[model samples]
Target: MKNYLSSSQMTLRMFAADLLVLSSILSAAWCLSVLNVSVPKTLNSTSGSCLLIPCLFNISKEKQNILDSSPEVTWRRGSLWSLYDTDGFTIAHRQKEPVMEVVGDLRKKNCTSVMRNLTSLHSDRYYFRIQAENSGVTGTTAVHINVSESVAEPNVTVPVLREGEEVNLTCTVPAPCPSHPPNVTWAPALGGDVTQRTHLNADGTQSVSAILNFVPSVHHHELKVNCVSIHPLHREDRPLLSHKVVILNVEYPPKETWISLTGLVWLGDNVTLTCQSKANPPAVHRWFMKRAGVEEELSISHVLSFTAAHENTGEYICEAQNLCGAMNSTNLQITVLGISFTAFLSILAALSLIFALLAIAIVMIYRRYKEPIRSETNQDQNIYANMSASAVKSEQLQSKPCEDKNTCTINPVYAFKHDLPDENIYANC
Candidate 1:
């Protein structure tokens, strides 16, 4: 902390010693300049603006303390010899009541003066003089003031361009200072070629212009073109840039059109069909119906709404048209079953009537039953089944011993249904 304080004090002491030395030198120079005069060779500013001319004069060190008394200064437009030799003199500065102001404090040996509303007529060699209480000093050197017009930003013109259309863009800059005319450039590097020329405006001002011609496409939409000005003034800093924007409005027809329905449209229900499309300039829609090989325009609106019925079943076409172009959608088949709640109730009532008649007929047939026809063979079989069980016995045979081994004598009884009832039995004859 002690070292820091010591270093701070040393820095302040050194600054004070340097300031004292500079004041002594200035004081000596002020006294010496009284014998001579000093002025700049040239100074420049724009016309209708202010000019700062650099000058220096000196007073005695004793008189320099009372500089607030306001030293008097004069600016003469002609040479010293001519002004003294000629009777008439053009005075540019009188200091108190004139527009020209002396910004320098005369006691400090600074005699810089400002000239306001500079014009071409004021571009002449001038002399500065300082008048004290009893002594006067005149400048030996002449200061030449050159007044010219200021550099201005270029005007960029971009026309209303459309796709595939030929267009031109122009950039204009006023060249009042023709020797230092500003160059104009466009950003995004447009067109066939950049053409430059100097032309005269109606107000008699000369202007330098650059033109760019091109055939604008859809890709150039909503883009900005800049007109830059490269001037010698503050060239190392940044160039002046101005821009004009052109937005293209492209025209195209409707495409990819389709229809949208509210719901599953049935008979006697209010249904809506909306036609839509994508287009630059929006197209108006109309619904067309082709029924029974006959075509007719149905509605001239974007939405077609009606009560659905069997008669409304047809090929529905959505047509879109605009000033640019027209388009038609593919055929859409719309069919209503035409079966409503009333018709469904009527069908149920008819079915119930048919079922009731069939039931009555069935009940009458059951009450009046009739016997079926039978064959005689079945009757015989049924009678035999009712006979005694002994009537179904098989016949027996008796064999006697024979002399030869291969031959035998036999006796058989051929009686059939012997125990059966006479009405059912039959004898083999």
Candidate 2:
């Protein structure tokens, strides 16, 4: 019976201990759920920088009345889980302090504070406390801080971009110190309107944002954009710079479609015509030949090469197409002559030589015919003059009645007889 009683007692004691532990855990959880202060669980800061702890608190009606009359807020640095523990060291009070200050109004339950000159040594858990003239002091939640020596890179967000569409680009940077928040700017200034804003994050770190508004164009495609964040806390020494880059991929249709020709296009000559265009996803080229009043599709490629012929003389057009859209080039007139330029020049030269030879022959024939006629004309003129003189001499002889009619002396080569009034004589000379 004694052994059984002892065993029963031990079991009961063990159950009571378990119940006690469970009750204590429940109580602690309830207290945490009803904590008077609200603050971020974690905060980030940089060495030699400042940070703001955004906080708020609530109290019982009686304590609230007292705090509204004469409230005093305080901040301590340490890790104390119990409500009655006083092991934490005071770092800031409602009064002005060198390293920390309670910037919030205690009467309004705002316990926000600012701490400056933070270093790795300042990395720890911090707690907020509130007290009034009559109201006892009350402690609230704690926040863990992490300090680093390097600045973080800025963040850039871009959206789907298209030509001729308005867009907004957002750049955000951590703002550890509100007094001198970081400055955010964009590179290659897009000539867009920029608006700035400050935000408090749930992690107790503030951020500054810059939004750029502009209309995108084909020129901005594949362009690199930069977001630069400048920290003023490091300005006294060497300024700290953090930047992020993004390349824009803008969607556009086919543009600036045109054609280029290579090699002579005269008859029987090999020639090539090339079509070109600018567009996203590239473009497919198609060629068409327009003659008299009809249009004929010629080739379906970027280049069209063929031997020049009379049938090739016409206005050529090239069409560039992509998934976005299509565009047509201006008319490219192609005239295929009957002969090549060199052959035409050679033929012209041969014709000129033949005409020159013909002219020379004509001139020579004219000179030959003219010289003979001139000689014959000169001979006839001499004979006429001789005849007139002979007539005159014969008349004179006749007038003298041939003085000695029968005794007339006449050379064998020239002998003429003149008839007188009573005598007539005829002789050969």
Candidate 3:
């Protein structure tokens, strides 16, 4: 009876051991069912370059213990295949060198891998697998890789730019391989400084970005900005290059204010002055005149027009303003030409005075010449009278001695009214 009890006890113990083993097996199978891998659904890579495929996995506690002891991580091409099967080809393994390598730590459940020297032929769906002892798990989700000969264009991000304001411009490109990151450069090199960074995406791919920081100005407005990326593949061949362009719209204050004249201005002439400036959002113009060291506002519009006068002859200035700021133009001098009415009248009066003085001098000269001619005529008449008197006196003296008594009576017509000495009268005869 004791022997029979021992046999029954052995059978019961064996059944109990079998039940525990079955329960453990069931637990492990459930754990394997829950195992999941995280990776990007699609990835792009340039031919002859390198690609980095980031990966992670999660496992149950029971599976973790199993994988912790001895873990083997691998990557394969084709849909959901394992090392035991001939359905797929292995591209990366934890051990041994292949076309790709599992760079992540298998102990930490990271399944990241790097594929180097890729070509168009390497474009395919890839899978991740983890094995521990006799138990293994294969992820259902696969990563599809698309390889192309030309690199993709980089992404450029720009914000609203304002004059004198600091800003940052971002240029981003896919960085498939960290070790062989693409070289990024800026065309026209518009920034004060540039900074580069590498970051991982939620997906398996990584990205590299170049940030340019600068202060914008009106000069930069409407200018095109270019972001260029060069991906190095093989030293024997030319590298792949991609570029993107964006036009800048910079907001700024008024600048380079100036005044332009249609033609030379003269007194009482119709003239126009046009004010101009460079600015975003346009600009408002104001005209001013600096006369006698005082500035006076003229017009509040883009153009200032009026009849030019003496008051308008001074330094002219134009002011351009916007929301940002204001600027003044260099002094533009305006001169009124031609003589004034008052000055012309003054000159005419002076000329008339000169003519009057010349006429007075001519009249005085004519009066002086007439006086000399009259004096000569009077002297000649006096001399003729004296000669006639002398001839008459001689005749009288000659006849006086012979017929003194008879002549004195008869010749009353030729009477001498003055008393003359008898001796002087005789001597003259």
Candidate 4:
């Protein structure tokens, strides 16, 4: 009888252990069931734009075993007001009639709905409920849809250009909605469609540029070009942002032409010339000279010295240019002369000495060859003197008594002749 009691006690202990294990398993399953359900609290969306309200949920382990078929998902606002009533919100099972349409694939358990053409009236709290078999659960999410009255204005940037250069205007509309993209158009302030080309960006926001390649005239100065953007909601036809006026002031250097003193320039000469041309930006004056064989630009002051020679001559050209245009002066020919005074004086002094020597030689030759002639009366007087002396001696001996008388009569008579005749041959022989 004691042996029988021991076997019964062992069986009772095993039964008690089995009951405790079942209780613990049931307690764990109950805790998991409560954690499976969740509800969203907030919704985010931009003002004056579309909103996508997501109804996201996951089945818990406890709820997974309860349903073999898809659960019925229903969308509502506030309390029981239904937004979408269908079977699990699936595309195939969804009721054809719904308050709002669902975009993208809805079968993959993605309960996301898009509210397009949203207005201020659609702003409110929304609720999503799931019903399966005999169990029903509800989750709540708040959607704040702000419908703004005005849209953002676009930005425009114009390229810098000189007058007469082609103008390419670009308009950029940023962060635009795909459903209602901004429309871009261009118009000139001067009237007429001067735009030549256009371009668009991939995003609903666009980049539109108009190329005006025409040569700008003075009439277009200070002209304003409008890059207008129109939205589906905008009532005005004008542009959202008016770009600043671009005044193309294409300036070129001043053009000038003058008589250039180029080529071989003799010393002591000035190179004078004139320059002519037209430009937006006036050109500058720069005079340069290059020697016949040299390749460098000679300095203005240094080019032709006050003593310029033939070697100083060379080809010359003037360059005039600015941002708009360029021009050059015509080539000029230059001539230079050389002069010295010292060389002339030396030649005159030599000729004067030669003339003096010739005059003296002629005078000496004439004096040495000529002879003087005397008169015939001078020779006859000499012979008469000798005869008178001999007669006087004889008379002295014969006549002592008449000495006194004769001496008185013959008292030494002397004769003088002042004139000589060149006709007589014996004048001075």
Pairs that collide in candidate 2 are: 413-429, 415-429
Candidate 4 lDDT over 1-429, as tens digits, reads: 899999899999899987777765565444334323223344433344454454445555555543455556555453332333354543432333224544433244445565565544545655555567866445434443344445444456556545555555555543223454445556653433444233333311223344334445545545666666555432333423323334444433454544433444335444444444555556544445556655455433212333455654566555555665666667654545453233344556667777888888888866655322233455566678888987887577555543343243332353223243555648656
lDDT string, candidate 2, 1-429, tens digits: 999999999999999999987886666555444437788888887777788888888766644565655656656566444443443333332122327788887767777898887777777877776545754444557888788787888888899887888999999998878987888988876878888899978755689998989998898999998988878773366556789998988878899999998655788888888899998878889999999989999989989988888988999999999877899999999988888878988999999999999999999999999998999999999999999999888666656634656455453256545445333334321
Per-residue alpha-carbon lDDT of model 1 for 1-429, expressed as tens digits? 999999999999999999987886665455435534466576655554455566676545555543555557777565653323333343333221224678776656777677775565677777776656765445556787777654445677777664566777888875544445557666666555677888855533356788887786645655566666554332233533344444445555677889887546567878788999976567899899999999999988989989888889999999998765789998888888668656867999999999999999988877655222245667777788765333443212233334544433343334243345565545531
Model 2 Cα shift for residue 50 (angstroms): 1.4
- Please, what is the TM-score per model? 0.39, 0.55, 0.55, 0.32
Pairs that collide in candidate 1 are: none
Ranking of candidates on TM-score, top first: 3, 2, 1, 4
Determine which window of 10 residues in candidate 4 has minimal summed lDDT: 197-206
lDDT for every model?
0.65, 0.79, 0.80, 0.48
Best by the lDDT measure: 3
Ranking by lDDT: 3, 2, 1, 4
